[model samples]
Target: MEIDSYFIGQLASEEKMKEINPVLSNVKVNDSNQLQFFIEVNNGLDIPADYEKYFKNQVIRCFESNLNSSEWDDLSNKGRYFRDDQFLKFAKNKLFIFKVDVNDSLIGTRLNVTKNSLIVKEKPKNISSNNEKTLTTIPIFRDFNVNKFEKNILDSKSIGSYEYLQEIRSPYIVCGEYLYGEFKNFEKLNDGWHVEYEDQIKKIPIDFNKYKDDILITEHALYLDENFLYDTLIEQGLEKLGTIITKENKIYVKEIDNTTNDFIEEIISEHEFLSTYKSNLKAKNLVYDSKQIINFHTSIKTRKLVILSGPSGTGKTQLVFNYAESLGINNSKSQFNLIPVKPSWTEDSDLIGYLDTINNIYRPSETGLIDTLIEANNNTDNIYVICFDEMNLAKVEHYFSQFLSVLELQGNERKLSLYNKEFIGRVFNADRYPPEIPIRDNVFFVGTINQDESSNSIPDKVLDRCNLIELVTPENYIELWSKSISNSLYKNELKQENKVETVTRSMLNEWGDWHGENVLNNKEIEIIKQLSNLFNSTFTIGFRTLNHINSYLANLPKNQELDREEAFDLQIAQKITPKIRGNSEELEKVFDEENGIFKILSKYQFKISNQILRRKKKELDIYGYTY
Candidate 1:
């Protein structure tokens, strides 16, 4: 058997071998043309008591000569050891054989060895200490030549390469056989890495340092070096090689997709719209309190119908107009339809479309209700708002009864019949008008109502179906005027069409689920139950009120600094208390100020003793009716 020269040299220089067996001496080349060393055990001679220790030292020396210093150091750190007897057993089995070759180049030297038919590459000298540390961590790609792979591509693609790939201006790295580079004018194909570059189908690589840009990567690609890529990009600037992260100590990085970007943009747009809407409201001298604004937005998001009911001259109509204008819906007749409620309206045809036999044509009312609904149905991407200015002037149950029932239906069930089915193509133009129009989720309704002798009272059915946001004029006239003047100047400089996009159904469902699961605690449910018990016979609430309350609490903007109980209090004041109206003695018992009914409903956390409810109760007691 041929022994390696390095192992033979280590055995020859080992003093422990000499001490353990004095007959064993220097190594020499044998006739077989192999490095030879011998050990002779004398008869009747006892070996040293620490013979095992000496043998172990020789085995370590052999390991030190053959293995790399880093490998030996790592093995030593791991507390690995081999007994002399173990080494002898390995040698007897012919397992100590190794074939190694050393080569030198102008750039650096390399040590190549064979183990189980796989070549073990030598450590490069050019690698920094930081990179060496990183290498130790990433064992999966320890044998991977990332630098050579990148260099080979750069060399091969230097000429006659695809123009789009060559035009990549930002430096990137390759991971998992996919190139991630930064380049402008790259067409986005999907939410993942699939792309069409220069009209050729290709897997578009993600941007290296420009991750915050419009580029996105596939989840499978991200998993390869998710943790190490961020640090590598930061350390090497934009041009460095992508480092392989150690698989053992995995770093988690969230993958970005088009859906995530869209969701983030939606949130940002909502915030921006809210800010601009507030500014516009101030510009128009319509000062809505924070609660009113929150409830208004929440109402639109959750229920799609909101009632602005308060005394006249409180800017209720102006609030609706300003809100629409802030959302870039300036065209009153197109995006928003203002229908004046007439006292003579007592049936569904008064508000909904009616068939006219005159001139052999089915004519819609001048209110443009059908046209607005048609526009909303066609353009589902935008938010369409309709305002019933002075809606209480007529009995809402008569003219708005169909809407009251139709709004309760969800999804595809939300449809309203315009006229007879035969009239669809014959009388009413089929191209522009259908027999029944589907009430889309994107359309929201707002009604400006007043409690007076001329207007009819809004019944419990209507009150329960909609969220009531009472508008009160600000008492601080000086501050209001100052804000209005400041906002008017700012409004003139801003773009006129700051339209806010409609939130998707998925987003609303997500918020609803999150709030129902996380935000609504047991204490709030108990409070709701107690409030329901207060109006036991008069106006006890069901799941509808509970759902509205939950949705209201869920849809409130995160930045709004309202406590949990305070938010619930606002829901009670807006959603629940608005429905409580009568001259019954039980009603008097619930609204009694001394009994603290409103306070109790709010869990005694915040006071809900607003003048809206008080005025309604006072009017109900005096006139036996209130809206």
Candidate 2:
């Protein structure tokens, strides 16, 4: 008995057979009970590469089973066997042979009269198609002979032969004298197959016969795929084509063709012009006087190093990060770095970089200060901020002395020596080899300190170089807590709106105009002169401190949140009083007899200054030191 062709097609369409081997292109059966199947090996289907062997064994089992048995009655058993039990069983008893052909290679296996099967032929062998060898060649052409078929086909055809090539499975086709195809996708262009379909042309990854004069041409109406063209432009280092952005499902490509410096200036200008003015620390939900915020900004502009010192829990570190966030830094490592000073640090290498003699590579400290400086050197247009949290944990003059000296130098003199030789390289990759790195002007450094037994005192040299801002815990706990909760809720709402903008250097310089007037009024100058006279060389005020005081006063907000006298008094308390600490009896002579307050030598008196001075006096009278 022979298996029916209809039964074979039904078996091929079964759900079970489709799941097991859907790539089977056709199935046939011979009078000798031999089953044959042709499956695609690489026809872009999801079939596995090794499916030929698995499908051949499954087809043999399907024919050997009894289809009309009780087990075969279940609908789930559709692909287990064909429905004709008599024919399949009779064919199985006689003999069962299965052959699979893939990519023109025939592989066969035979089942004995019993139920066992073995390989009838070992390795796969090439098979001939008609009288042709059917060797796989490049730029494959159609089988039609134009000379023979032109009389019938050409007369009736509306579209040209090249137009039909678009519907072919292969990506290439030869017609008349040229190879024609559409670019399925254009990833890159090299010396390979060149295709043309209509106006669209591309160089693909197929080979062509060197002897053929295949010239491809098309009308100029077609355009290359935008994504493919954009990628190719970038891969060729033609970045002047700029970037592509999608909004509302439409793509917009922006091209830039300016010099590097001009391009950076444009980006900075855009950021600054788009940014809205707000309090420096407003984003962090902290309520501080507007004058203090301006003063902080001015200090950063004037002096690159700023010190935030006060008691712990006064939001010192929070202030540093909040100021950076307000400038759109957001604590990104490329723009900002937070180095926690360790108690064990005693030398510059512990904070900057050191030579690993055993590895012969220079290793930057865990603080990443060297990496941050290197980045600043490479990107001069942008600003970089570094915060030293709890900086007093280490002796500042010892570990931070290198920065103190290097920062004072100008231009090329500001280079920091990291290794002894000029060819020192990093441990991981030697390509990044640098013996000295310049400390760029664009970087800003901030330090937060808490004075206690666990921390060391900041030396006078460190104090003289940087601006000092003092923060005390808020007196109104109830109001602070309530506002914190409300600000958090407000930020959540703001996040939903997704409003983001950048702040830039030029904007900062323009904003500094709020403090454009550097002149000091008579009363302000008198107050400074009195303070300097009263200190009497014991704690003499220098020109830097005087300049900083004038700058702070000039930069105060025009809204008059703090009166001139009040603002000057706050500066006196922060900039001068913090430096006035001693166990000498001469300091006691400056204290008031009645309230133990340090009396101002000038005729004009400030209540805030009196309070801060009295507090320092009490500390000096008892603990022998005042912070």
Every model's Cα RMSD, please? 27.0, 32.7
Tens-place lDDT digits, model 2, residues 163-273? 111122333333343333332421111111233234332222222223122211111011112233234422332233222211223334567666644544323321122
Worst 10 residues of 1 by lDDT: 135-144
Clashes of 1: 0
TM-score of each: 0.53, 0.51
Clash pairs detected, candidate 1:
none
Q: Residues 373-407, candidate 1, lDDT per residue (tens digit)?
A: 88888887666788999999988988999899888
Candidate 2 segments whose C-alpha is farther than 4 A from its true place = 1-285, 357-359, 409-413, 420-433, 484-488, 491-498, 513-518, 554-564, 592-607, 623-627
Which numbered prediction scores highest in TM-score against the true structure?
A: 1
Tell me how candidate 1 scores on lDDT. 0.52
Global lDDT of each candidate: 0.52, 0.50
